[model samples]
Target: MMTVVHHRTVDVGGQAVFYREAGDATAPAVVLLHGAPASSFMFRGLIPLLADRYHVVAPDLLGFGYSAMPPVERFDYTFGALTDAVEGFLDTIGIRRCALYVQDYGAPVGWRLALRDATRITAVVSQNGNAYTEGFVDSFWKPLWDYAEDMTEEKAAPLRGALSLEGIRWQYTHGVPDTSLVSPDTWMHDHMLVSRPGSMDVQLKLFSEYPTNVALYPQVQEYFRTTQVPLLAVWGRNDEIFGPDGARAFRRDLPDAEVHLLDGGHFLLESELPAVTALMRDFLGRALPV
Candidate 1:
């Protein structure tokens, strides 16, 4: 468990960004970036494992988590802007080189930083991160994509309902093998994130901005091929959202990339932390260790 050590704020582009850090500062850094509707709390369980040997840091994205959201007008909330924010974060903390564990929305954030600072990345451990053309499962994302394409107040807003606590519980267990593990508090917390004032609007707009990333997928693949950074993909075999096809696709761009499709769904990290953490530790030890 992560013992609260007073939430510290960092200045990123004039925004007071909040984050949680653990372990020895002198150790090689291992930063974890979370996805939509989630805060750094997503990695709370895994932090202690990595913290024992590596400096671990996890941040709530600008508009998500406990971090400050300076109105949509002040910030674009697009991937380009987020990538720049993360770059500034690295520079502010003076992390010359670090290994990144990316999940969900973190896929784009980490990839954006990877493309810009490929030389600075020593290793990457991705849990359900996007890569290759196959990873883009059209059918699974069709509903959300359609909503983003044609958002309106009257249209069937499954995506909108899906962001709520009740909806999130279903999402976390739609095709999951272990429904028993879907704790009430988990859904409640995740729901609380998207339910905050302006949070729903933030998510809706971010959904609209997702197409920009879809358009830039090709560039992301090229970066993986060109950078040749040590990469590993740990995906939940039963992920209804991202699907298994996406996991196989990582090999097309990264032939040497290692992949592990474990038993779980979208939020696989929550179910398979021990396995994921072990894989990350082994990979980081060889590729980016102190």
Candidate 2:
């Protein structure tokens, strides 16, 4: 029988955390953590593909998606807080150990989870999720990093377009060779979410705290070397942000880690949905062939 995405909400210490679950609970799970300006919605198309063999759960971080979007002023938007929220969700849902699939902003949150409790991680699949300092290349992140240092209205003003209709549209379409493959509804939905009152503030707070994740790279790399968790890193070579170098870095720490770079952009799943599905399904089978 085919499994459909199941919409469910669980209260994680009074916070209503929303997630999409599929497949059998008894099977090994694949926890999908989405990136910024997006939620579990990004994983909608990818979930059912793997649901047959693996339990899949994708949650929106505290400030993103349909999850409770508390005001930035009221809630802590740091990566640490985000990880805590995710850990709580895992606990509440009775998911003790699972494979982690991290993409974009999901990188920091998921990596922190793995580092905090390495034993809970069955394996890791990194898709355009970067951890190395070198991964933050000059092309995509330099301007954002500059804005982070100053954080003045003037400095941040230049980046406001990223939250706009066209900007969010560009985020999904830009690096892909065939722009037609990108869906307009993807950005249109995202624009509506960020357009909500106070969402921008939450984004800005998280953007400024990105350096914290960078600082954690040392610890993350150390965890990789010591724990030697099975890893499968599939990157989009065309991604301007979190470029291919980040994918290759896994080999430095875990030489046996399987890595593949595909011809897609930051939101590679958008453009290479079938290809990514095939790669992930195959990788998971090999990486966790028990």
Candidate 3:
């Protein structure tokens, strides 16, 4: 039987937030937060798979996918602001507690939620969602790091290429042993939305503020140690942006943290969906039982 997935939108702080929902609302809630250059659309495959056992909700962050893209002037594009929107969205929708599946940009947002109210997060499943200083690949982040130190058009100019169609394509294909597994639709869809007027600026603003997430690594690790929230790190071992070190680092804080390094790249779902889904089902079953 096919699990029915619903596409819906709701108002969160006057902004139209779009989300994909599945399974019964009464089931244990599992919230999926997508990374950069992707939206709830990234989880299209995973949602249905998890819906059979868990109530799954994947939302497009304010500036990504079908969600409202308020200009930088009106909305601060920092991760903190994004986290606020997600927090409010959860409150408005009555998801008091949920297991968070975070990736890339979603890490900061999800971690921030955990920081705000430790009781709200039932478990954490980080898929290339980094929260450690050692997780970053210097070669990949050097340019962005420079831009962070000196916020200027010149510094930001070179980084804009990353949001280009070609760059987005590379993001999806890179580190994957078999590029054929990555669908063109993934990058094309991302490029279309990212190329929108002022979208680049919005992305850059978030990029510049990424260091803030790095700064909070200690606090996040502390939460991991003290609260000892259920944690599972299912990472793409070949991801260059956030290497395997980040995944293994989780064990430093939570010695019992379950870590699985898969033979895939950044967008593991594209190449290893079944494997990832199976791991998640097992982990969530143990952490947040139905």
Give the TM-score of each candidate. Answer: 0.93, 0.97, 0.99
Pick the lDDT winner. Answer: 3
Instruction: After the best TM-score superposition of candidate 3, give how far the Cα of residue 152 lies from its true spot, in angstroms.
Output: 2.1
Cα lDDT of candidate 3 equals 0.93
lDDT of 2 at 288: 67
The order of the candidates by TM-score, greatest first, is 3, 2, 1
Q: Candidate 1 versus the native: TM-score?
A: 0.93
Candidate 2's residue-wise lDDT over 89-156, tens digit each? 99999899999999999999999999889999999999989888767768667667888799888777
Residue 52 of model 2 has an lDDT of 88
Q: Clash pairs of candidate 2?
A: none
lDDT digits (tens) for residues 15-121 of candidate 1:
76778888787889888888777778788778878887888888778888877776776678887887788788878977888889888888888888887868777
Tens digits of per-residue lDDT, candidate 3, 147-208, equal: 98998988887678877889888878889999999999999999999999989989988888
> Which TM-score value belongs to model 2?
0.97
Arranged by lDDT with the best first, the candidates are 3, 2, 1
Candidate achieving higher TM-score, 1 or 2? 2
